[model samples]
Target: MKILDANDKELMTVRKIERDGNTLVIRGKIFGAMPMVARLTPKEARAALKLLDFKTFFFLLTLLFRKG
Candidate 1:
């Protein structure tokens, strides 16, 4: 997955996502910067999903629908 700014410039790349036991591992990079990874347990991931702002979610939905 690719993250873009409002102008549609690529900001980050989501390289990989994998499950390790009860946790989810996310690996990605910040544009022009070092790579980063994060691990979140199922509970934490669910909470984070709930915290997504409406505009961001709408932007993502637009991207999806446009592609389809």
Candidate 2:
């Protein structure tokens, strides 16, 4: 998954996603910035999903629609 700014400039990229026991590990790098990795439990992931802003959701939806 790619994270973009309002101008559609790449801000970050989700390079890898994996399951670690009951947790989800995400690896990525911010464009022109340092790398980052995060581990989230199922509950944390759910909570993060619930916190997604409308614009981000719309961006993702648009990307999906474009692929189809």
Best by TM-score: 1
Per-residue lDDT of model 1, residues 3-38, tens digit only? 899998888889999998999898999883879898
TM-score of each: 0.62, 0.61
Q: Over the stretch 1-68, how does candidate 2's per-residue lDDT look in tens digits?
A: 88889999999899999998999888999894779998999888789889889998788788856853
RMSD values for the candidates in order, in angstroms, are: 3.6, 3.9
Question: Could you tell me how far off, in angstroms, the CA of residue 11 lies in candidate 1 after the best superposition?
Answer: 1.7
Task: List lDDT for all candidates, in order.
Answer: 0.86, 0.87
Which candidate achieves the best lDDT against the true structure? 2
True lDDT of residue 59, candidate 1:
88
